[model samples]
Target: MKRFKHLLPVLLLLMSLTAAIISCKKGGDDPTPTPTPAQPVTTITSISPATAPVGSTIAIGGTNFGTSPTSNTVTIGGVVATIVSVTDTQIVVVVPTGAANGPVSVTAGGQTAQSQSTFTVYVAPLKPVVEISGTTFANQNWTRDKIYLLKGLVYIPADFTLTIEAGTVIKGAAPDQDPDKKNMAGTLIIERRAKIIAQGTASQPIVFTSAKAAGQRAYGDWGGLVLIGKAAMNTTSTAALPGGVRGTVERYAEFNDNSGTLRYVRIEYAGAAQPTGSATRLSGLSLYGVGNSTVIDHVQVSYSGSDSFAWFGGTANLKNLVAYRSFDDDWSADWGYVGNVQFGVAVRDPDVADQSGSNGLELENYDPTATTDVTPVVLANGLQQTAPVFANLSSFGFGTTPTTNKSAKGTGAYLAGLYLRRNAAVAVYNSLLYGYPEGVSLGATGATPGVTNNTIDLQGIVLANVLTPVVGNGVLTSDLTTTYFTTSGRANQIVQSSDLTALRLNNFNATTPGFLPQSGSSLLTGAVTGGKLANSFFTPTTFRGAFGTDDWTTGWTNFFPQNTDYDR
Candidate 1:
């Protein structure tokens, strides 16, 4: 009986286990109902804007992205990206910080899709960046902590204001490396009526530089800063000058219209040329149709591939400008620029010059500087003449000492101090120009800008070491230089090169040379506030050629940007 009882307990245990198994089979084991069909593989077809900097929005186009944004997850370079919007076929996501170069991946409905092509991510800022591209529709403020990398032709449309904090650094990314980008440079264009309130302090000047590293930076690494406004210009079409970049046009004139403020700013290693067919390279700061109300002061342009500063059809007044080692002209004005410039300096390198001839002021009314510019008899569209007043300019071109090859890339000829051709009506007072082929090369048959006409006025000038003080370059014979420029009450002096030695500008030929006038030098004397300088636009100063005892370009200017740690 006891044995039977033990067997009965064992049998009861087996029967209980069998019953549990049968119940489970009936409840949950119903033929493993047709397996839920695998989710459609999320296929990535394309990625628009394949290249992007950190903190930029990019589109991921594909299929199988769920309609709800929460259901989809996107990652760039393995870093999680914020999904801005999502659709079944497309997903828009903002490239998050810390993103690196990698393939983009998206996950939706338990299915995943990855891009076959690698996404290029650029982050060349000191710490981080907010990249700017295309056109700025809304008002934006750029801070100083992060360097803004301009990806393409960044435009600030009219009425939109770009407020830049002091000490901000903006880099123009070179587009020559990427064949997909259309433009060869990253340019900043302030369209007509657009405003840029960039008022930097002397200690913390705004800097616009190339994206290359310190040692790798060179001339034309990227594009320059351009300001286009509404102001009177000499040309009917204003297409002659490159103020609107390569082939863009300058629109109707609106005198005294404000563009914006550019004070205590530095634009370094700029002036990159346009794509293939462009004949002209961009300038460091090109003002097109800018108005006098736009303030431009204490601006330094160093290592420019082309001109440091250029104006086309504008009345924009600029002062305290420094043009250091430019490839082309230091200052250029054309297409009826009637602005006022004072307290400017041009430091030329005998080793650096352009094929078109590098000079201090390359003045012209339009593109054609030949005798075809006989419009001196009649103005274009009844606009004002190109009569910009320049005062206290020290254009020191030491061309005699080294006897340079002139051009950086190819062989080029040494030009002049002020090459005034075409129909230019300019007025210069209290300036020093030295060490070129000629101090002032006057050409093109023009009656309005001639000395007899009084429109081409040179009130006070110190001409030294030039092969010819004043000469008609090829077409025009300047009778005024022999009879009026030297003999008249213009206070113009033709000093010998030895006089500059007493100035004590030690090692002025070097890359980082001293440029302060010593005590008892003749260049420090003979400044006047009479004649054309009597106008209110002129700031009355006792010193003559741009500097006397103080070097205004000391703290803010970077003479050796080749080695500067811009990221610091």
Candidate 2:
């Protein structure tokens, strides 16, 4: 009975030890870690830079991207991208050349992920180097997006039209180093019967500038824009007109010839002089016999080497013309020009001038020769009259005092406010000529008989702060003042007075200038109120100057051409 009891106690102890071992196994050591839920299949959330061109790097954002780049394969637009970097939540890859618009897919491990949105691929336009030199027979259209690099002398022949789209930019390269060619400057010429339909808006205006970098651009960087038409121009050349005759040519056009339009256009850093020619110098915008039907409004010519705007025997009227820092004349008319100009403003640089003679308005009836006589009665081309009417012209020069002549008079630069010579029959009205060495000079080669009869007819002209208000080189000064200035209709001639406080010109001599008259200025209401320019072609405004209640040159004008990036 003692042996049986001992065995039962031993059995009980063994059973208790077995229960303790079972409890320890149930509470210790993890059970296979649950496999981490398979990481949710590594979903893709989005892609950065939804649209990109070829060769651009795009980023893919998602969850659970593999750490190794080789493990993750990203394809954009069905083309495999070169994976640059990879992380757990993002991947950056370069777009391949053959990429198109499609959903970007990423494949890692045994799973594949696709972006919810499709990526866009933009095809860049091919920038072709258009070398336009010869004549164009058919219509030529220059689009806005394409970049045109102008080569040598590009001319539009007769009966053709060159249509430049709005916001189009035309750049001229540097002059070629051709020794044989006198002037290898690039020039765009529109021959008679040819037209340029460059109609730009206030927001998207056409730009003509140098191809050089902005800070490297300068005056005379390239040749200017030239438009030649079949309009009446009284030139001394009896030989047959090279382009065409106005009355007898095959496609003879009159003053109302529609030579297309040039609106809201900016011509910068132009006016390169030809090496050898009768017209050696070129202006920013040269109109050779451009008829009245041609539209030229809101045109800004800045940093011109020669005249800003010159009309060589054309009746095309201009308005809202801004001539900024021209090296030579601001507005010039020659070859029997009879066009009417209104609302023209010219701001001159104190140090810039030409040795030949620079003036605010240089009117010559005909080409001057040593043998030509200065007779006003003599008609130009023996048929036409050299009468060009100018109204509401605000010519601002660089002079502090009445006799402050900063420019070199005889050697470097000759200064004049209004140079009426060469039998020029110019009528100035409602004009302001301020700060000039010589205000108004008549007769370049000394006055002859009947000089004052047809030379100048001044009315409502303000010659303020001028060294010499009215003077004649060879004619009697008394006779000039009596015949031209002291007429019954002539009035309001201001000279050397401090009363010019009304003209609120901002930085008149600086690179950036503003010519808008301030409030309470006399220029706002001093204009003729009878609608002086109420013709069909002109829009009548009560204000006298180019800028009035509305600043037309606000949006498109670029005052600082030196800093602009033409390529951008």
- Each prediction's Cα RMSD? 19.3, 11.7
lDDT of 2: 0.73
Quantify all predictions' global Cα lDDT against the true fold: 0.80, 0.73
Tens-place lDDT digits, model 2, residues 312-341: 776788888888888889998886677788
How far residue 404's Cα lies from its native spot in candidate 1, in Å, is 7.6
> Where in model 1 is the C-alpha error above 4 Å?
1-125, 177-180, 238-251, 367-382, 399-409, 446-449, 502-506, 509-511
The residue pairs that clash in candidate 2, if any, are none
Q: What is the TM-score of each candidate against the true structure?
A: 0.73, 0.70
Residue 253, candidate 2: how far off, in angstroms?
Answer: 7.0
Top of the candidates by TM-score: 1
Indicate the residue-level lDDT of 333 in model 1.
Answer: 87
lDDT of 1 by residue, 1-568 (tens): 9999879989999999999999998888456577779657788999889998776799999988989889998999999999998889999999887788999999898988899998888655555866778886999899898889887678899799999999899999897643347766887888888999999998889999989987899988888999988786666563554622433454566678998899999999898887656555789999988898999999999889889998977788888999998888999988778888999988887777888888988888654644543334232353556778899998978746424355555357568888887767688888888788788877656333366666678867888778778877434576755556686577888876666575445456546667777777877777766777877878888777888787887777777778666674
